[model samples]
Target chain A: MGIKQLAKLLADEAPECIKEVPLKSLQGRKIAIDASMSIYQFMIAVRQGGSNNPAAMLTNADGEPTSHVQGFFTRTIRYMSEGIKPVYVFDGKPPNIKSGELVKRREKREKAEKELAAAKEAGNIEEQDKQAKRLVRAGTKENNDCKKLLELMGIPVVNAPCEAEAEASALCKNGEVWAVGTEDMDALTFGCPVLLRKMTFAKSGKENIQQMNYKKAIEGLNLTHDQFVDLCILLGCDYCDSIKGIGPKKALAFIREYGCIEKILENLDRKKFTVPDDWVPNEKKAKEAEEKEEAEYDTDEEKEKTGKPKSDADEEDTEEEVVPIYVKARKLFNEHEVITNLDLKWKECQVEALTKYLVDEMGFNPDRVKSNIEKLQKAQKANTKPQSRMDSFFKPLPSKAGAKKPAKATVGSKRKANDTKGKKGAFFKKR
Target chain B: MFEARLTQGKIFKQLIEALKDLVQDANIDCSEDELSIQAMDSSHVSLVQVNLQAGGFDHFRCDRTISLGFNSTNMSKILKCAGNDDVITLKAEDTADALTLMFESPGQDRIADFELKLMDIDAEPLGIPDTEYQCTIRMPSGEFQRIIRDLQVLGDTCVISCTKEGVRFSVSGDLGTGNVLLRNNAAEKEEDQVIIEMEEPVELTFALRYLNFFTKATSLGGSVILSMSPEVPVVVEYPIEEFGHIKYYLAPKIDDDA
Candidate 1:
């Protein structure tokens, strides 16, 4: 959903921005994973699994189905075994701007479910199998169950204020964690210093994860991070619609020709792009200056849809929600509330407790659980220095970055990393 | 009009917790004597019936008969709101579309209320005729549940065989096979793994998932009764005190090779 044509564009324009590294090389790295995204990828794994019936998702004696539990358990353990410490960050209250996107996704899901049911009723196995993959969803119970299971496994789970990707990027930028592991291109738009894609590693080998080095990306594109975000929005982002005819190639050309988003929109032929009626360059500031309490983009449609009368709280809500789409998305990316400055520490694996939870509560096979636990226990017993703590874990990584990473990342970025010294110290302080 | 109250909320909590796995929405028939619900699972591979006599409730009144259709999942959620010691009262009118559940602490200090919107589910109670079985096994519900759970990891279906030797559960798949045999003893107050009475030795294979769902009711009693007839559905029952009971009927898995 994050500028669909962006990856292809990057492949063509900036090949140096992406690198396929061995999954094992990420060993001893403190990674903040997008929990919902990982859960979703695993759900699809079970849904489209060959031969195995999706309806036969693993469940307890009470018929409480848990599709996410099996996949997450295996993946988290896989990450841990590979010496990658996973700190899962879950999404919090969605930004009001994203509410429209969420509604559209929900409608699509409902329609897919209806179609799947109809296909099944018609005794069309092929169509049913195709629609089966479309109707999969990780519901609330599944999410809560995942949190509980991951907590019981002794991994740190953080609840972010708005978006998991943004929180993860903020942490990466602050040098609290090593990188953000997600399949989302939006993580790049959020300016994650390092974005990890193809994270479904346990199943797919070799290309465990593709690291998108943001510094290298910006250097190749010859644009600042802000400009990249504006370009992403112009191409198309989840928060708002893009100009009808504009795409990744055209958007890049526009950014290269014009200085920023404002200039391009100002110079565009209105008949082709169809910019929103009220939209203009820096429209937020203009609207606010015209009238102190004026809504920048009116919340009239949203209010009418919700059938709510105007109140003090409602007015403030509208005021916050009515900002220019790109401005709102950018602000959310910059000011996302995440758990940084907390003790980002890893505790030794409590194998016995993990084994007990898996066997007794989850109904996992005792021998299989024990075997996996044994592997982790053995690793913990032989724990080396570089892999032990969060701060010291990345000492060996910077040199690797110097060799193959961005040429600009060598000297000037050192001082930029040096600027995060106080923030890093705050993050590593023992709780 | 109908109003039923239970001083011990744990019983009501356990009842719904047991039925949740077997049925989605069930019509609870409240009459002059008892409350009963009989419904099949969506796949029709298993049927569950829950019975709670009027005598089991601390206070019960039914001016007229009513069928209250409630989703078991929502019912489980509401039961979670009540403390095990809290008294629970269910209030509903014959014509109303919603049922109110009131939970009051034993000291009457705190009370909470929830309204459950009822559905007019077009499901009629299934009429099950009593069947005399060739083999009947009475064993600790915990033991039976454990065996089913353990063997479940190995295969999708398990064969339950009751011969002169004992009661055996066997499952085999890509992971290899597992056989757990529970023999019987008559005179001992605490029998071995099971107590078996066989008019004729019988063996039947059934979907392990259905058997696992049946075990959700194991907490209702000390022991589970499995009455099986060759080529017929197995009847598994867990009896509650005061004539209340939860019963499951699971169709045997037809072996195509045989």
Candidate 2:
């Protein structure tokens, strides 16, 4: 039945009972939660106590675990107790392309943390001083515990290969989940069948709980899900950072008529559009490669028969093995460091050994290791073997004391001097 | 279960004004057609609960139970610029974390997008003792708001004395004393004032600020019902259509001198 018909049926005969639907109906439902979104919410609600400020220690003066615990459990339990079982997803390692964004964020947080520490040290307290507490609350054990508790409650959780919300949306499209529950509109672009707003325990008594069906919601936008996906790509999703000057409403208009990402790009009046330089297929390829590497590392096993060491060359033989660029990149950097430090020549076997060590001993994520190995391989490919400046630069120099000084040719020794002149010219010219 | 889309602006405007001054963070409990918010202030001196009926909104529709995480601050901001009469549409975005509050005014149109951020606010179960109150009074909401406003001018503390004769609200400060005494249906009064009498004497002191904020909310409705004991906090309740009731509780002032 359509949602309206169902809502009507329930509303007329059994309003009270329908409101109390068991949480199980939510099972396998995709919930798109912002990984970094609710940290401030926790800080504001969680009580503080003791020096360590452990999650368990966080309680009100009356000894009640305050809003943080309340917000987490009430919503989680309410959903579970009802039939709408949820798939709780968390974020995993981000692609390197996002490093710049991450770097900027880290810098901002560091500055804020420093100011907060200073304020506490100086004891210049104000209501705004809560901002300091907010920072400490940002990445804390309490939040992690909440996620863990949800998992222990038997909710399916995906450590999303990337953005938790985006991955959750993928699940929605796959029909693994009926709808996505989150506060972010970014999910709409991810193409979920339905997006539920105001779905919480707090507004349970309100007359109407607002829900939007994706098909109806996007009616005016006139864009198919694929086009909408491109719109988000243009606007920027976790996959690709957003293009400047494009937001939800504007991107919707652009993609609705264009029909596809390629059509929009082609039809765009050059003067009106400024595509971000970094928004290209290669960047997406790089990200995909990086994700492949991470997933491989998550499920890596060492085989016994290869006592001679299985190089990435062996990995290349595997059908699904996606070589990561970072693996080779790390080796190239290390080789540079070794050559610069010890003035040694590049050794292929040593690079391979380091890659193996990183994978086996260091327990580096295979995806990450593969990427670094690929980077080193690329560097090796770019340079001519044994002929590049790096190769000769790494060659050991003869020690001053070990070499005999050539006997100074007597100025009048014509026969020996003529032979030496030709030889010296040839060597010096080549150098 | 029952979905009606409200297109009138006045309803939204009135609703926003009614909700603005109340405590921003409160857990509203709802059952079927009834919704209530219960919260005590930091001092435990005052508590306020706002109730509204299911029919209060134009598009009142709910079949299944849902609890919304609403921030009074955000809602107030959205309601601020709304005209007294405007058409607004309220719709659920899905079974998720968003609600669309759309306003269509004469020259301007706007949509206030709100997402309920999950908060970890815990509600402790409070056991309220059931007792026979010494005094119960029904007063006109306008007069109540004025009494609170006037007493606030005197000082932070006020004494509310109710007797068989009438209800007396007085405040004494270094400057002077301010009192508003009204016998049941006395003289010419504003349409908003309707005074009632008590069967017995009940007197208590309370903070004026709490009283001021709490009583001002009575303006949203026609009248307020008050139940009180001399030593305990007062309970002020506003009953609205559709089984919605807003109640405020103000604790008695502790006598430092005594």
Candidate 3:
């Protein structure tokens, strides 16, 4: 997934970097949320009936799913009622390097679809429900519906060029947002200034939002920004496979000692670690290969187009060079394409229009929709004053014997409070 | 067209046997003077070069210079079909896609021919600079082979230290450490002597896995020569009788701890 179990690792090693804050403290602050991740969670969690008909999704009269709309609509109104400025960032086209992950997801969905049909034939209600949840994907239709709903609510929406977490982190880095709010731990690796988890809870007043400060985390771990990225890559990101024997603790130790993956790899005992066959290329060998390919530069297409006679060697040398995948992943984390100069202006909520779109067009209850719209209008009217900056509210908590103790409570609840059932590995049966 | 005849066919067979493990495919550049081959292993950590002068052949003729590309394993398989004392002739046209081999027994009563398919191998010629080494050691081929094989059992790498007094090969691993030292000795037979010539002392570490592969050429010569310098690849040379030699260039492993 995203730096597998990175939050736990950070909590155990650098608890001083994270702090628990009351949800009310986020008032008058701009938070950028990853819309695709939230929508996927809603599709997995929101269903019609409890035990008997778990496969029945919340749908309108035309039998189209309305669960994401219901969840996103209520969540947006809740944020507005708390005097919070929310900017929704939607995912764009995934990078080419993520094709392998996409293929795996597709294969899993197809297998689940077949299993679902068999369950339906056997009249096994529980099995059908499990298989149906495995098939839930936040595809184009759901994303478009969420975009339309956000625009109607007058919240600023950003279509990220790649991953939404990276773009949301960019927005936070540029000071346009106070923090990037998403459950994915890779927001830290994306270099977000402040990462807020448990922001999308279902009206839970007991659980406070967990805040992780990027600068403090780096200082506590005693690593540079580049070394932190290497640590995440080693802990297994989406782009490449990690070495067989390395886990989070060993990965952190190696980063601290060797300073980077290349050095760690050179000094590591191959007999002990048993590195992945195609994990990372030896730099010297890759350079020599590049030189050899450059010296024999003759394209088969050039021969065809220019009427030059093609030699047999041209066919043999046409195989492309192998560029290691981890290099691409590292580059992506360093420089993800986002709208750098953001003009995110939160506008007034169109009360009448939002009511009609939600209640009449989306088959929502008219009374509840009107009440939520009223709350949005009232909060906007009271927020006519300029919003406060993050630094004004957040003085780095004093590092005392008790300051680090608060992180354990928040991190412990944060781990168990992840109700997002559509987590990457949760759909498969554990071996 | 090109054709070359060799009286002792087994030499060619032994040459292929020495190279096939290190390189899969290579191009042999043939000139009026000699036949030369240069190729690096897939890992690029080691290189092998072979040079055979035309004067050493029983009969040699070449109108112009040409290059022949082949897979070493396939060439070795074809070479194995010849008898030990057979007269072997290699024939190929300028633009032919296959090389022709003919073998005749010593009595001239038995004759056989085989056609081996050629491949289009694209190899870049490396510019190997000729530099004077600091130390050169000449020892019996069997002694070098035994030392490499014995040290391989202890560790994956070997540190070679050469001085005016003698040369030492040392290795260490989880099991323990081992070292073998050889002093300068002049025996009655030239091949039995162990000689060391040095301008300055130099020590380098190399992966023993590749040295073990280089020892496959022990059957080609009575003695082996090792040339070493600082921050450079060591040259392991096995000289053939009067024709030329097969030299292996192995880059030393730089120990960051050292």
Candidate 4:
């Protein structure tokens, strides 16, 4: 559903932009991972018979299933051991427009649940296992548990105001993270400079992960970044239905030939072709805004601030007016919020509090927890040399938003700094 | 209160490798004269017994018979770091919840030591009855391992047809069908081939994966003895030289259960 077939099309067309890199080789780099995606993955692993009944998975003294806790704990330790400091970005409330996708997913899960019941009745063990995987859901409880565990492990958890991937991409664009780690290529459409996929240790038979460099992809497509987003929207995105008969290949050719979806729609047969209501021509004002030549001589800092997802900039101009829906979708991507000025400074682990959180409360084996903690300490001593990451965050943004200039970031004030950015009035009002 | 030292670390390493996959956790019972561990796989479909006499170790001492619970997989991982030539010592205080393992090279240089915490797992010992089986066939352990490995590609369950003639292992699935016949040959020069003793012909279908899992102990023994009766579980035994023996009992997969 995320720009259907976009990754496959890119794989075939722009092979050079995708480079395989080992997880260990990502040492000394900070990666922004989509936390909800990782939590959901671990939740599914727990649900679909993670050797659940026979051998208890990582639990605490209360014997509560800490699949997310264990997964985050182990993975954080493993990554930090390899010298890859991580900032886990979690999704906030989903965009209201994504209700359609959510409903569809729920229906699919319900259908799978019914199939699983039948499979269990029929004693089809294999079929039951497959169908059970679909019934798993990662809800608020799991997310909070993960946040606690990550904090215990001294990893930062960024709760995004919207999509985690969007927030991760935002972080990447700000040079706060080396890359965005997510399974979906939507980050590329959202303009993440670099995206990492399949960053798992026990992948079994999975092929090596390849990093997607966004700028290189645009170069390979021989189009501007805007045109590439338009291509993705044409191929279909989560926010809107794509134009009929326009897949990745057709969308690429149309953009190359006509330059944009609106232009391509103009030359098409009215009865034979179709696009989303917003994708079609809304009015002449939208067209006028397109030709208004953008401001020039942009430095890197300026570029970071103006990286206002395509949607934010367009919506800012047409605050009350309607534009193509893809413009709205792009604007939504632009408006999606991320944590900023975060004191992502990893701290020394508190084994006592960690033991209380995991072993005492959650019922994890105390011995295994102790052993893993020792491994973490060894990795920390041998690899991760502590340095200041807050310097870059506190360094004055000389170009824009001089209003919140605090000059320096105190560790205690980081929460306010992260949550205060992007519509503080609306955020508190809604809460 | 407890300490044991082995002349070579190879036995414990091999012991870990043998039962790591089948047994999740085990309770190692230590006494003055002998050390024993008895546990079953999580499903209770199989049981493993590891017995080591005090004489087997270079040094062994225990004031009281106490059980130490451990996760076998974790033990297996720790054992992987041991060198075959290293002399290993296991030490634990009476009230301690952790067991320390010290591995020293034969030359007394380069000593690596680590500790594993024990769990108070309430694992009860199952009383297994001794029953006379209709057939007991002894064959080279490698051959049995190979047969199971080869047929696992074909199906999940294999039928072990035992007759006065020999034992036949066969499996069929969507991939195709395969059959391996091991007829008794008294003149076989490999020491052990297919030795069959059948009161009457007995055929039982057992899960191939469990058999393959049980075969993880192939390094512990050179030959395998499979004993079966009309509808009973298949008893697979691997006899160790001076250490002890490990046995696995797998329930037959009934076609009716499908």
lDDT of each: 0.72, 0.48, 0.78, 0.72
TM-score for each predicted model, relative to the true structure: 0.51, 0.35, 0.53, 0.50
In candidate 4, stretches whose alpha carbon ends up further than 4 angstroms from where it belongs are: A46-64, A204-207, A276-322, A383-431, B1-258
Q: lDDT by residue for model 3 over A277-395, one digit each (tens)?
A: 44544343356659775443233332233222111113122424333446557777887777867788777878788888877778889999888888877766545533332233223
Candidate 2 wrong stretches, greater than 4 Å: A1-431, B1-22, B28-30, B93-95, B104-120, B125-132, B186-193, B241-243, B255-258
Q: Whose lDDT is higher: candidate 1's or candidate 3's? A: 3
Candidate 2: tens digits of C-alpha lDDT, residues A1-431: 00112233223322321222222223223354443344335545444444433233244455433345435534554543332345565665554434545666678768887876776677656522554554554444555655554443334445566555556566666565656666555555555566554465454634234444556434434455565456545555433345456555556567667665556556766566665534333344456769775432221121122222223233222423222222222221112110001111222214555445444543446676565545444433322111111111122222222121232222122111112121211210111
Native-referenced Cα lDDT, model 2: 0.48
Error of 3 at A173 (Å): 0.8
Could you give candidate 3's per-residue lDDT for residues B106-202 as a string of tens digits? 9999999998776544344565656899999999999999999999999877889998779999999779999999999999899999999999999
The global Cα lDDT (0 to 1) of model 1 is 0.72
Q: Residue A366 of model 1: what lDDT?
A: 89
Residue pairs with clashing backbones, model 4: A59-A363, A59-A364, A60-A362, A60-A363, A60-A364, A61-A363, A278-A324, A278-A325, A311-A330, A311-A331
Docking class of 3: incorrect
Residue ranges of candidate 3 with Cα displaced over 4 Å: A281-321, A386-431, B1-258
Scored on chain A only, each candidate's TM-score is 0.79, 0.47, 0.82, 0.76
lDDT score at residue A56, model 4, on the 0-100 scale: 27
Ten-residue segment with the worst summed lDDT in candidate 3 chain A?
A410-419
What is candidate 2's lDDT per residue for B1-258, written digit by digit as tens?
223344555544554455456455444433345444555443233455555565665556655443334556666666665555656654442233334566656555654433333221223224344566778777777778888887777776777888876888988876889988877774464444555656578887776776677765664567787787766667777665343566666656543210
